[model samples]
Target: MRRSPWSTLVVLAIAQFMVVLDVTIVNVALPRMQTDLGFAPDDLQWVISAYTLIFGGFLLLGGRSADLVGRRRIFVAGLVVFALSSLAAGVATSPLELILFRGVQGLGGAMLSASALTLLMVTFEHGRRRTIALGVWGGLAGLGGTMGAIVGGVLVDNLSWRWVFLVNVPIGIVVIAATFFIIRESRAIISGRRTFDVAGAVLSTTGLLAIMLGVIRAEPLGWGSIEVIGLLAGGVLLLAAFVLVESRSAAPLIPLRLFRTRSLSLSVVALGLNSAGFLAMFFLTAIFLQQVRGLSAFDTGLAFLPMGIAAIVGAVVASRFVTMFGTRAVQVVAAVISVIGLLLLSTADASSPYASSLLPGLILFGLGITAMGVPAQVAAQSKVRTDDAGAASGVLNAGYQVGGALGLAVITTLATAHITDAMTGGTAPLAAAVGGFQFGLLIAAIFAAVNIVIALLSPSVTVDSATATEAAELEPVAI
Candidate 1:
């Protein structure tokens, strides 16, 4: 007998959680890792950048691979690579080794994340079941990022910073083993010659790499720097070439026609903007709590617990509401809530108390962001063809990563300038920093507000006849 679809979802969710958690888990442990590995201050950023660059860069390729190759095969392969890299990263004696291992870990993450989503999409039939599954997937993914701070802080405080990386070993092993017993292999059925879009993959991967690299370095090197400008410009040109090639190729990595699907296209844009605002809030708040309020990493993590709870509630609520009302309505209402949350957060200062000032905003922001995310994700997958599911999911995921990088880069730059102005105006250093963060929070609020328009533009209906057709095309194959 086959395993339950819910059982497969559990396995995939666990793996996806592990991958997304790594995106921010290292934030609290960076100092410890730097000191232990003898990292220069300037070079310390590489530990984060390397992973982001590689993971975001290769996501498109990884997702498409899931379609061409077997999804289960790619998923298992990703787990092994990720687990081994995590082990090596934890044991590294030098900064270079750690960074190298982290980059490799990112490659594994790209594969694992993309295939996991494909498996979920193909496993669940369209309608309420798929919506619920997507909600669970989206919620866990969002929570993973928030929980990273808590998990990292606990590990670094109780054990060593190495535990942050090493913790994945057992989890990965269990997930990999469970996959063999529970999940069946599945691949898209191609009618013509099974040719991979080699040219499209290369162009898109390298182009995205260049873009991520440019964005990551912009804060340090300045956007106007020759290196940053060259990388960004080159990435744009390469992506343009990739688009051109895709239009001509018989078997494109990403079908240009997918963009014509209004629901899918709009949902992707909405998700990207959702990530931009949502992630920037987390980044800014972490710094605000640690630097301005002088909270220890552990304490800062504890303070975020309420927000995590709120997010869980929001996720559940969004899933139900979308079924009752539709994605467009839920998204708009949820985003409005997020805008309010961020605006409330912007009023906080160094002297603001957690209970009175920070807690309320955190609760609202978490709820709104997660609620907003679920619908956006559901809408994106709602109209996708089964054969195109992997590619569409890849673009959706890539949009989230790239949008986040852009948000952080832009918000950080703006905050820095604000702080500089405040310091120059004779504000004390601590006060200036607070003011800058407050301003940054305001900008994040703006980003959240933009999602309202995207939500409005999204397809009005959630379930369509096309969804049933898509579901008909998917079937599970036992190995």
Candidate 2:
């Protein structure tokens, strides 16, 4: 059966949006969930961290599985798991149950998200069609975080915190039903080789999970505490071992050779840095609007609508710009724009007005992030072999999640320290909080500045019309 490209894109985009939305949707509902479930102050962090740890840890494995098993099959399976787990989360009567269900949701998200990108890459030709498809993909990706807050607020305020998880049930079911009709199954060709590298998967997944856990715990545990140090050290050592295992494996989970492509390597680095700043902005901004400005959840979500709209517009513009110029040039320009936005945000204080002080910076930040993200995604996937498409997508996403986790931890620590110092100096509580947020914004600007340097130093690669056409025609090869 033939499928319309537009239909396929719509279905996949919905799935991707749901997965990404879950990341931030819970933030607005956290207080309610804690109160309802009787969660401890420290344990509440687990609601977010649990999902992140599993999602980041298993992304590579999930991507590789999509290549080895089948893209469409894995995607459907992921949706089922996601929907079921979401249902469980909604009905959870205890904190442990909610956390457990969230972890399962993350596992499903990893599988669905990795497969969705690989499927998109294969479904559309790599020319103007693919570029446009990725533009929509990038735009939705940017909007999901912002929209999560919006949608979450509405659901929590009007209904209950449970609605945040319950909402995914209907969306997941629709995507799953659509998948059977609109998506085609594709997998890497395997000869007599082993289907997967078990050792590599275990080592890599455990290593990444440890690293994420360590970072998430660092703020609460004290960065220099023995537990944090031990976790970080163990994670690094395991990752080193995973490198050794992959270097020699006949069927490695993530091909080490992929990094040899300069565009792929640099794009991954840039994506990580950009995500670090992007997510930190979302986190701190939400806190500032609510805690400092005294906005209701509904109002805070409304405040972000302009930024979400701007991100979609920026994504469209980025696609056209990438088509006209090149990924390297567009990325550099985008990073510079993001730095300017972050600096503008650093000027915010307790008395700053939303329209005058916040809106302008939010617009620039939204535009710059989507612009940077679209090109980076396109560049990362440009040079990969068809058989390794899933792996490439997974690695890129893993970088984003890992970078976000680390960035949030580091920036939060800096903000907390600044707030304590300011309070000690006799600053009022509200003033101290605003000052800390401003400090975090400054550090976030530094992260974006690093992205600019990376963009400048990265090798230039252009996807012209002719080259894109050639890439579109390339077929999968049997291993």
Candidate 3:
């Protein structure tokens, strides 16, 4: 199959958007889901965590599968799974059923998202075209969370919470049908010498799941609690075992040599740190708006609309910035901007007006994140070999998912402890919540500042007109 590059991008971007949107779409609808399904308060968290854990755990395996089998095949398979699971979730009669379906949705998302990026990489050459494509891709990635909230709100308000899941069914079907005609298949040239590293995959996936479990549970259980400590320790040991297994495997799930590329490694680190701060910002701000500012779900979603718009604008401009200033410089500037935004947000309180205090910070953070995210992705993918494209993409995405999980856990814990202290000191509930959110914002600012340092340390890599034209001339893969 052959298709116009733009059409191919549209297909892939839509798929990516659907997968990413699910991450946060259910958040606003949680209370409704709980009431309908009779969920216990503690068990409600699983509705979100189930998707996240499975997505994070299987990302590497999904990426590697794309490399070994085929991108188009994995992408289509993922769509089928995602759509079916989404349908199941929509009609779920019990909390356990919804959670299980959501886990399946996450698994499908991992396969789809991992291959989607790899497909984009293969379809576009590594220069201007790729940069522009990635900017769009990264912009969508940034927009997904905000959009999810918005879409979830409208659906939940106008129809029902189940609409959020049902919506994916139609979109998935359209995408799957279009994909077969529009996208071509591509995979690494397999060799008989290579074998699947089942042991490595098992260890890495289980290790990551355990780590995320520990992190998520830490919010409910104290960080110093025995269960938390044990889960964390076990996770670390399993990951270590994964590394050892990969070192000895004939076909490792992730090539350790990929990390030897300083740009890729540093970019991955920056991506993780950036995601940690960015996602924590979203988590805290959403809570602040609803719990403290007394905004309804619909209003809260509207509040974030500007952030989504700003992110799209920033993403559109990022390619040009990368062309002119290089990835390292853009990353540094973006980090600085994000830090300022976080700091601005830290000053917000119960009395702060939305326009004066909240909006400005949201805009700045949105702009900074899109600018940083696109270029960081480009930098990481720039030097990777075609054979390792899926694996590399998986590693990058894993950094994002894991970082968000870990960051949310740590920041939430810190904020909760602060809230506890304030309450013990006789602070009002709402005031304490606001104070705790402010503290979390401050910590998030620190994280962004660290990203600035990391970005500054990264080696410079720029795109020029010559490279752009050269890349455009290269032939895309054909099935």
Clash pairs detected, candidate 2:
none
Per-residue lDDT of candidate 1, residues 255-363 (tens digit): 8888889987887677667766766677667667777787777777788788778876776677677767887898899899989989988998888677888889889
Residue 164: error of model 3 in Å? 1.8
Rank by lDDT (best first): 3, 2, 1
Which residue pairs come into collision in candidate 3? none
Cα deviation at 17, candidate 2, in Å, is 3.0
Model 1 spans with C-alpha error above 4 angstroms: 1-10, 30-53, 92-100, 120-146, 177-186, 212-225, 381-390, 420-428, 462-479
> Candidate 2 local accuracy as lDDT?
0.78
lDDT of 2 at 263: 75
| Per-residue lDDT of candidate 3, residues 1-479 (tens digit) | 45688789999999988887887677667767877899864455567666766777678888778878898999999999999999999999999999899989988998898789879988998777887887677566656766888888888888999998999999999999999989999997876764657687678767876776676577668789999899999999999999998888777777899999887898778877777786678767876777678777677778888877877666656656778888888888889888898998889898878999999999998888777876787777678898676567677767766666566656766777788789999999988988999998998888888888888888777876444222222101000
Q: Which regions in candidate 3 have their CA more than 4 angstroms from the true location?
A: 1-11, 30-49, 91-100, 118-146, 177-187, 216-221, 381-390, 465-479
All candidates' TM-scores?
A: 0.83, 0.85, 0.85
User: In order, what lDDT does every prediction score?
Assistant: 0.77, 0.78, 0.78
lDDT of 2 by residue, 1-479 (tens): 34798999999989988988898787777767877999864456567766765776677777778888998999998899999999999999999999999989988988898788878888998668987787677567656866888898899889999999999999999999999988989986677774567677678767866776676567567789999999999999999999999899887777898998777888778877776787677767766777788776677778877877777666667766777888788889989999988898888777778787888888998788877876777777788898676567667767776666666656766777788778899999989989988999999999999988888887655765544322222101000
